[model samples]
Target: MPRSAREPGRATVQVTNHRLARLPDVQSQEVAPRTTPGSGPVVDVEQAEAALVEHYPRLVRLAYLVLPPGLGRTRRVLTAHALVQRALPRRRASASVIPAQAAGGTDGGGEDPGYSLLRLQVLRTALEAGRPPKRTAWPRRSQLPPLFPQVWGLKLFPRSGGAEELALDQQLSALSGPARAAYVLRGLERLPEDHVRKVLSAAGVTRPTAALREASRVPRQDALLESPEFDPCSLQARPTDLMRRRQHTKAALAAAGAAVVCGVLLAVPSGGWGPDGAAAPGYAQNPAARAALDPAKVTKVPPTAWRTSARTDFSVWPARGGLTGDTALLRRALAVWSRPGGSVQVSATPGTPSGAPAGPPQLLYAGRVDAARVVIFYDGLRLARYAEPARGTDGAALDFARVDAATGAEAEAVVLGRADGNVRYLTAPWVTKAAERDLLEPSAEAVDLGLQDGVTAPLAGPAEATGSCSSWNVLQLTEGSGIRLLTDLGELTPAHLTVGRPGAPGEASEPEALRTWSPFACSLAAVRSQGVRSVNAWEFARQTLPDGSGSAAWVCTRADTWRGDGPRVLAQFQTPGGRYGAVAAKAEGVTACGTKDPHVLAGVLWKSAEGRWYLLAAGSSDTGSIRATGGVTGSADGNLLAVRAAQGAQAGLKGTLEDGRTISGLR
Candidate 1:
C-alpha cells in the first residue's frame, strides 16, 4: 500500500550528543563514519531519524493492530511512536542493531537483530502503561472510545457507518490485557515464542500461551476483521485494499451523515397517515414506510415507525445480583433509544455492590444497524468497592470512560435506596446549545432519589389525560441539580411541562428543590410478578405513542418468559378513568427473551402543538427484533411512558418542508 508519511517531531537532545563510539552494536551499521565536529563519537542522529520517519506510519498501523484498538488514529499513532521512541535513544547511543531493512529503508524482515530489543522495550512499556494502579494514558481509549466523529452513534454505513471496524475493535478489546498483548506481539509482530514469553514475563503474566489462546477466542459475529495467525508473513491481504475501503467509505460517510448525531434531539412532525401507513402529506417516499420496505433500515426513522425492545442481554455484573446494573442499563437505553421526543434520567455509576462477587459486567452494545444507537455502555464496569461517601458532593467524581473494568481495584459505591434496596435514578443537567456541542456532551453528574418520587398514577391515552390527572415523580437531571424531583402530577412544574397549568411551581417558582416532595418508588416488587426471583426498580410514567396515542412506558429489567414473571416493560394506554392495559405480555414458548419488541411505545417520536399532532416511539433493539410472537408489530403499544426531560433544550424548535409535514430539531 502507498502510505502517507507522518511528519517527525524533533527531540530536544541533539543527535551530536549520542556517543556512537562507546556502544558496540550500532558501530557496525553504516553511519556517516564520522561524528559531529566537536562531539567525540555518536551514531549519525539525522540518519537514524530518517529510518524512524520512514516506518512511523507502518509502526502505527502495527500498534493499532496490537494495542487495545479503540483510540482514534492520532492517539494510536502516538502510542506506536512511543515504541519507536524507546528504541530511538538506544540507536543513538550505539547500543541498537541496525534494521535489516534500514540500509535500504525497506522492511526486510528477520534481518535486523535490534528489532527484537526495540519491540521488547516497546512491549514492556506498553504492558506497564496498559496495566492498573496508575492513571496512565494507555487505557483511556479502551475505557472511552475517542468521542470524535471517528466513532459516534452507529452511523457505521449505508456506506456511511462502517461499524465493521468498530465491532472488530470492540471484540479485540474484550480480551484480557495479557491476552491482548500476547496476541499483538506474537500474532501481529511475528515474534518468536521465546521472545513473546519475555514480553509476557515482563508484563507479569504467568501464562503466555493461555493469554494468546484467550484472545484468539474473541467472538466473530458481525465483526469483519479476521483473527491474525501465529505468523503474519503467511497472511495474504494488502494494506492498500483496506485503506481503499476506508477511503471509499469516507465519501459515503460524509454524504449520508444526515441522521442527526447522537444526543442531538431532532423530530419529524406527525402528519395524517394514509391507509398504507404512509404520511398523509408525504415526500417522494414516505420515510416511515421504509420500516415496512426494509425492516432493518433505521436511519432517519419516520415519525410513524415505532420500535421498542426489552433486550435481555447477559447480566453477569448487575447489582443486587442484577438490579442495579439493569436499572442503569435501562436508564441508558431510555436516554439513547427514546430520545428526539422523550425523557430519560441517566444516573450511571459502575461498581460492585456491598456483597456482590465483583463489579458490573463490561457491556458494549455497539449495534450493526445503528452504530450510533449505543443503548448500553458499561465500559467503566471495572470499578472496585465503595469506599467513598454514599450521599454527598465530596467524593471523587465517577468518569464513565476512565474507570477500570476490573473488580477489586478501586471499589465503586452502589448507591441503592434504603426504602427498597433498589437502584436510585439520578439526573444530569445541561443546556442544548447545539447538535455537535452541548447536545452530544455527556450528563454532568449524578443525583440522588427523593421521597415522593415513588408515588404513581398511570396515565391514560387522551391528549389531556396523559401526564396530568395523575401523581408521579420525575427523575430530574439538570446542569444545576444532582438529584431528581419526586413530585405529584401537578408537581412536574418545569416551563414546558407546566405550560398548560399556569399556577404550577417551576425553576422560577422555587430554588433547586428537585429532591423535595419526590416520592420514592424503591420497591422492586412494584413491577415484579410471581415467578421471577428478582426485579429491578421501576416507575410508572406517562408518555405519548407513535400513533399519537397517550400511554406509559414501563422501564424495568428483563422478564421471565416461562413464568412471565419479571416486571412488564410495556403497558397499553386507555381512555380516561380506565387502567392502562398491558400491551406486551410475556408468554412461554412464544415470547422470545433474546429480542426486544420494537413496536412497544416508550418515548415520543414527535410532539407538535404547532400542528396539534404528536407521535410516540420506543427504542428498537438491534438484537433480533423481528421475532415477535404476534408477527413483530405493536407488541409494546402502551407499556412505556415517555416523559419530557426537565433539563436540556428549554424549548422545541421547528421548520417546514415544502410538503405539509414539519421538521423538528434541537436548538
Candidate 2:
C-alpha cells in the first residue's frame, strides 16, 4: 500500500472587512469566583465581541456542519448563534467553561482564543443537539447530517471498501459523544492532537482515534500514520466513573458492526450502510462505476437556473408565488421579457398547475400549503416562485422552482450566498414534497438526504424605499425567463430575466443557495428516504507541491467571500488498483418527483476484479422516497456512481464555489 498523496496547491487569499457598525454592548458585570484555575479575568465583553466579529461567520458555518441539515439552514444558523451566545463567557458559568479547557485555560492562556471559542461553541452545540429532546426518539446515525467534507481528509479516494472517506463519517456518527468531540476538535478543527485527547478524556473516550482508526482499518498507510506530533493534554479530572459505566454496557453493537466507546451506539447495521435504514449487503463492494461512464455520454449541464423553457400558456399562478404579490406585477414581469420577436402575456391564475386537483400540497410550501407564492406553467408542467421568511424583520430567502419539460417533474434549484453577498448554486433537484409526506425532516421511509453548503445570509431589500412597501418582498419567476423582485403589488424592478442564473454573486442579492439548499435537502431526503444513492466528494486547500503545480484554488469556492488560491474541489474515486477524479451526482440534475430513476446511482467509485477504477455518474430519473422494509430494499437501484472513469475527471475550474462543491457528486 502507498501513503495517500495529499499535495495541496497554492490557494489565493480573499480579504474582506465587515464594518460592525454596531456591536453588542460590552456592559460591565459582576463575576462569581471560580474553584479551578479555569477562572480568568472577567470575559472582556469587548474582546469577546471582537471574537464574534472575527470568528462569528466561521462559527455559523461550523454550526451548519455540526448540526442537522433537517433543521433547515436558517434555524441552524440561529441555533448556532444561540449556542455561541449561551456559551459566551459573559456570565460566571459561561466564563468558567470558557477558561476550563479553552486553548490554554489551565496554564492561564490559550494558543487560539477565537478558535478555542469556536471549538467549544460547536462541541456544546453538537452535544446539546445530539441529546434527544425530552423523550424524543433517539436520532439514528443515518439521520445525522453528514459531517463537513473537510473531516474526511479524502481527496482522490484514499482506498476502497469504505476505509478512505465514506467510512470515516459513518463511523464518527456512531461514536460516543465524547469521541465525536475529540474527532471534531482534533481533525476537523485541526486542533493539537494532545488537546483533542484531553477533551476526549472529559467525554470518556479512552482512545481518541479508536473509531476513526477502526473505521479505517487498513494497511500501514492509515489516518493514524498521517500525523504523529500530537500528545493528549493533561486533564485535572478524568472520567473514570463514566468509562466504568460504559464497560458495563454491551460490548458488541448487534445492530451496527462498530466498536462503541463508553456505550456509544451506532445508527447503522452490521452489514454495509445505505440510505434510509436498510442494510447495504454490498457495503464492502465497489462497482468501479467510474470506468463504465464515458465522458462523451456525460451531459454538459449547468447546476442552477431561474428560467423555464417549458412554456406556461396559463394566465393564472398559485402572493406566496412572486415578487409583487399582485396580479398587475405579472403583466410587468411579462413585459420585461417581451422582446422584438417574442411576446410575453401571462396573468395571475387562481388555481394550481392545469387544475391538478389543488386540494392541498402534500408538504406545506412555507408551513401553509394553501399557497402564497406565484406559479406559472402549462399542462402538467409547473414553476413555483415565492419568498421565504427572513431572519428577524429582515427577509433574506427566495425560492425558485420549475418543472422538467421532458419528465414533467418539478424541482427547485439550490443557491448558497457568499460572504460578498454573491450567490453560489448548490445541488439542483431539491424536493418540496413526495406524495403525502414531507422529507425535509427526519423520515424513516425517506432517504434522509443531507447537504452542507456552508454559508447563509438574510434576504435583500430595495436600495431606496419603494413607496414604503412592506419590509419583506416576494419574488417571481416566468417560464423561459429569470427571477424578478415584486417590490410593489404591481411592480417589478431591474427586470433582468435569466435563462439559468441566480442574479449576481455579491451583496444586495438573494442568498439563493441558502434558500435552495433547504428545499433541495428535502428533495434529497425524500429521494433517499427509501435510499437510492450516496457517494464520495472531496475539497483541497492551498499548498505548493514539490512538483510545479502552483495554480490558484478558488474554482470550487467563493473568491470574494471565501476565496482561496486553490481551495477548489475535484470529485473522484478509488479502485483496487488506483484512483481517479470526477464530479458529484447532484450536479447532473434530477427531478423532484415521479419514478424518474428507479435505480438512480451516480458518482459511486468502486473496484474491479482487475483492479481498475470506474467512474459513475447519475443516470436520468426522479422519484420520491419509497419506504423500504424487511422484505425488500432499493439500495440496489443504482443512482450511485461506479462507472465512467478516464474521461470523467472533473474539469478543474477557477471561481467562487457553492454548496454544490460539498454536495455529493453523481447522485
What local distance difference test score does each model get? Answer: 0.29, 0.27
Candidate 2 lDDT score at position 641: 22
Tell me the spans in candidate 2 whose CA falls farther than 4 Å from its real position.
Answer: 1-42, 68-78, 92-118, 136-171, 174-176, 200-667
Misplaced by over 4 Å in model 1 are 1-51, 69-74, 81-87, 90-108, 135-167, 202-207, 219-667
Compose the digit string of candidate 2's lDDT tens values, residues 1-667: 0011211221111111111111111111111111233432334445566666655544543443445434543344445555555445642222323332344322223544544554464555555575556556776432344342212211211122334444544544455555455554544444465656654444345676673454233222224312211111111222335565565554534434444442333434463332211111112122332111112221122223212434221111121212323333232212121211122122221221221212112111111112222222222233322222222212212222222231211122222222222222222222221111111221222221233321112223211111111122212222222322111111111111111111222211134322211112211111111111111111221212112323111011110101111111122222111111112222223321112211221222222223343322222222112111121112213222222222212211111112221111222
Local error of candidate 2 at residue 301 (angstroms) = 82
Residue 415, model 1: Cα distance from true site in angstroms: 66
- State the lDDT at 341 in candidate 1: 17
lDDT of 2 at 419: 22
